[model samples]
Target: MTNDSPKPDDDAVRARVIEAADRLYYAYGVQAIGMDTLRTEAGVSLKRLYRLFPSKESILEQVLLHRHDMWNGLVERAIEGGEPRERLLAIYDMLARWFDEDDFRGCVFINCFGELGTTTPRVAEIVRTHKAGFQARLAELVAEAGGPQSLAPQLAILAEGAQTTAAIAGTNDAARQARQAAEVLIDAALGPATGTAQTRTSTTVTTARPAFRSRR
Candidate 1:
């Protein structure tokens, strides 16, 4: 006699592996972790793991996709109910929260790019796409706030620079410093704030709480 039970679907199994791989990759770096370790961490058979992700590159691709979703969600939450200028500044607020996480290491895309970008074209493309998406988002926010188009890239640079600085310096102060610089840039581009923008800036600068876990 054979006992029958429903097995988890491929999507569920794939998600589990991606999640486990994400944790290991972020903690140990992608090049350092091997398939056997992933099998143990994911609690799936080696054969099954190979079946789900034919190669390590395949798994890394899925991991980056998952991280993209998380990054988008974080930005959306940070800018949720604010006016255009407030929304622009809110990006830094979100960064401040992320920097404060105990496990924060830095931007995962940047990290992966440094590790495999030169040799791995696929990995390089993914990292570029993620960064481009962020720049586009900042452009939209700047336009909405009636600021010059040039201001968006400047703001993006600050955010990107802050991530690297905070990670290397082992301090969360980078975010606050970036936010302050952003205020000056925004004012320069769009002129002085007349209404609630001033109030929002002061409040957001002082009252950031932990928003999400850093995947990297």
Candidate 2:
């Protein structure tokens, strides 16, 4: 009997590998999942896997990049239909919903950084890139809301803190709490409410250095 299995094309193989890697790497830390297991899960031959990804590190980098794209898409879709202010709040709302997902495992980038960042240069770089991209998105939303650029970084920190707290405490309240804090920050940064009678400062105000300690 002759073997008649059709060879998988590069696109199909790449998708399979990334799909498997995303699932496995996110669930079981990067260091724990080996290439052999990825091969089995992806249903790709060892030779094919190597041909697609020269090494495990390369696959890990690709997985992180894939995750960054996925995360950005999720946030953008959630906020796309909302007003400028709504767009900022939409981020927290999305996080709250995500926290309730059955397989919620903190953040893939955060988790991977905690687990393998010290040893994996590519992982560390990917983590930084992911975070920088998120901050950039938040900054865009802040500017859209007539908020000062200085406030964007602060809001981003609150968002990150909320995720870390929610994941560690296994509670759904962090997003709400963060959202509340974000509203206060956004309001202060933007100025008094239109309905409320109050004197407004005409001169530009500069923010002092952030008091929050570094999480790094």
Candidate 3:
């Protein structure tokens, strides 16, 4: 059992700042957004917002972390309820909706890195760490699907590429096409193991629920 007590007020304020930053960064490129604009957009006072994230780059780190966690949570839940092949396909299905947003810019991690280019060590670290986790989980799922070690890295590249194309092409259909291509790649790599994958698919008005959370 767990008690869901409210966080201390300051912590809650900081979380709100991070959420606002995430929304802004997702809709607009990080370089295009400034702290004053963020203060106005978040409706938090300059003094208070600074207390939460001392710098815009700091806010960038939080934004990336929050979105990466949310993405993992959604995918983990989808994978749990789906079969192996379905689980593999679920990754793209999760990305597809993001492309439909009016302000759809691109995959945040890749986008941020492209802009930063290792100039900010902390921000760079956040992207690398988040992506490493993605690779690790993807590898595990690939192995579970009875794929070779090579297949995990290969599938990860495809997934990342799919997200890139969706953002670049500015259409939902691009992602679908990429997913189909990835499925073919996975099939060729795994042989008979392909059919043994997914057991179910998601059909709903609701977003896939988060399957995991931190102890905090």
Candidate 4:
């Protein structure tokens, strides 16, 4: 009893499902998209799709996790090497580029939390994990820059605020403002970089704030 039917590659099918899910989920809220639409968009048979992801909940979870990897990878690449202080500024610089993307939406976790956090405990946990990971990366950078780990949360606030404001206002200048504000915080915590700490007095500790401009 050999029935000849081409079986779909699991890896290929899974990638397609994730790709379609990412586009649709980000464009429309997760709840609004149905399995039929996903199957059609992914161009996979219903059985195959089911085999890859048993339910919409499974697909949504995978999609969020996939995006977390991608988003974090981009940030890591942006801050890969350079002055620790400059790496801090580069966080906002990277955001400016992301904001300019045609498909730019606010932070994916933030959007997901708003839509599903109350109803879905899994979704809430995913969002919390992503946010914690984000802040942890910031903490690493801050510590390397000779700033206290305590400044990481404050910097994360500025970054999140800038991201939200940019999404609403449709401008990247928010990142620039955030970067400028970050400079003040970093200087306050780390003191002057070029000179000795003894050279810095209480009145001269703060550096001159410059007009913010988008670099990338």
Find the candidate with the highest TM-score and give its number.
1
What TM-score, to 2 decimals, does candidate 4 have?
0.84
- Candidate 2: lDDT of 99? 87
Residue 48 lDDT (model 4): 70
lDDT of 3 by residue, 88-190 (tens): 7777777787678788787788888888957876667777777777877777777666667887777778778878888888788876876787788777876
Report lDDT (Cα) of residue 168, candidate 3.
80
Misplaced by over 4 Å in model 2 are 1-8, 192-216
lDDT of 2: 0.77
Candidate 1 overall Cα lDDT vs. reference?
0.83
Per-model TM-score versus the true fold: 0.86, 0.82, 0.80, 0.84
Worst 10 residues of 1 by lDDT: 201-210
Q: Give lDDT per model, in order.
A: 0.83, 0.77, 0.71, 0.78
Q: Report clash pairs, candidate 4.
A: none
Per model, how many backbone clashes are there? 0, 0, 7, 0
Q: Residue pairs in steric clash, candidate 1?
A: none
- Estimate, for each residue in 1-216, the C-alpha lDDT of model 2 and write its tens digit: 223333547777888898999999888888899889999999988877886777787777777777777787787777765456767788999999988888887888899889879987767777887787788778777766667899888988988998889888888799999999988987788764464433322221121211222211
Candidate 3: C-alpha lDDT:
0.71
Tens digits of per-residue lDDT, candidate 4, 29-85, equal 788999999999999888777766767878878888788778777887787666777
Model 4, poorest ten-residue lDDT window? 200-209
List where candidate 4 sits over 4 angstroms from the true fold.
1-8, 193-216
RMSD of 4: 10.1
